[model samples]
Target: MIVKCIDNNNCSTLTLDKEYPVIAEAPEYYVIFDDKNQETTCKKTRFTIIEDDYFTQKAKATITELNYQLENEFKDIKQFTIRKNSKGEIKEISVKFKYY
Candidate 1:
């Protein structure tokens, strides 16, 4: 199977017997299949995984909600971090506040 990292424009060809890392910084990508021997006349097909869409949308919503809550309830916040799991799922959010 061949996987293309849509955001980074990177491609990797993998065998069926080995494990691969599907999660990445930019989770958007397409899986492509192409025959190398018939380069001139071969047909290629690509597939998009919807998990990228779901995770991105969920992360955006979580970020927006956190920002709003922090702005209103924690005015001293100086920085924040959005944590994600191995599957690229949002796990936890941490914030640092300034003390005066």
Candidate 2:
């Protein structure tokens, strides 16, 4: 099963063999099983099942669009940097242009 972390600082998707029990829950964080089925703690607001085909489709579309933009819009970009959060979710992108 695929799950998404709802935490803003760690908004990333994870694949798991099966669902696990919540070891603990708090106002800011919680604990659950990670992809390896190991007990892992995360933000309380994090971790949700990725249900339905709509989300998957949208994710693919978004990736395609991002690739297109990188190839076209950023063709002239001299340098760029991608910033991701703790969960490996992209947080910010910075681009630099060549000056001639």
Candidate 3:
């Protein structure tokens, strides 16, 4: 899952308006990789989910983790295809982004 920081909660680990990946979430908080790529627990109120997909291919991870050099290349994504299993677990995610 991807999330954008909304409040930052006066913490240094997060920056408002920046997108971060939610490695996991609990009832009241989310586990996110901080700016240093360290796992940090943050309150749910600090961020809002941007996208959540249940596909095994890890497309969400791919897109968010792609090298910065390619970030521009994948900007302006045109479409996405997500496949889910019977239990609603993601099986695959295929994204089509515009190429400059």
Candidate 4:
């Protein structure tokens, strides 16, 4: 999993790459920065599993975390072949802003 900060107009993006089947989760406040650290204001952020493509011999479990977890029960790498994992696979989950 890789984390990044997007400094364009108060927005940031995070990217995660897993070799095995895993649940990708992000915290409600995924992108956080203290006002004291910087002169800019921080806004509320949200994350979601916009896309899911996990196939195994058994049923999968629900992902309910602010972080990513890998499931190696099947150990089969062929299932993910159709879906290529690369820099291009990154997806934007959400955008944040202040109410006022």
lDDT computed for candidate 3 = 0.82
Give the poorly placed runs of model 2, Cα more than 4 Å off: 1-13, 16-20, 48-100
Give a tens-digit lDDT track for model 3, residues 27-96.
Answer: 9999999988999999998988788756534865665655542566646677778999999999987767
- Compose the digit string of candidate 2's lDDT tens values, residues 1-100: 3446544344233443334456666677656666566777675445665553468789799677668767897665688899999999999977676677
lDDT of 4 by residue, 1-100 (tens): 2223333343332222211112233343333232223322322232233234443212243232112223543332223223334766744333222233
Q: TM-score of predicted model 4?
A: 0.15
TM-scores for every candidate against the unseen true structure: 0.30, 0.30, 0.52, 0.15
Off by over 4 Å in 1: 1-51, 74-91, 94-100
TM-score of candidate 2 relative to the true fold: 0.30
What's the true lDDT of residue 14 in model 1?
31
As a whole number from 0 to 100, the lDDT of residue 3 in candidate 1 is 35
What value of lDDT does candidate 1 attain over all alpha carbons? 0.47
Q: How accurate locally, in lDDT, is each candidate?
A: 0.47, 0.62, 0.82, 0.29
> With candidate 3 superimposed using the best TM-score fit, by how many Å does residue 66's alpha carbon deviate from the native?
28
- Model 4 residue runs over 4 Å out of place are 10-28, 38-100
| Better candidate number, 1 or 2, judged by lDDT | 2
lDDT of 1 by residue, 18-99 (tens): 2222333233442233233221211122232334546778989978977886689867678979999999999987877677
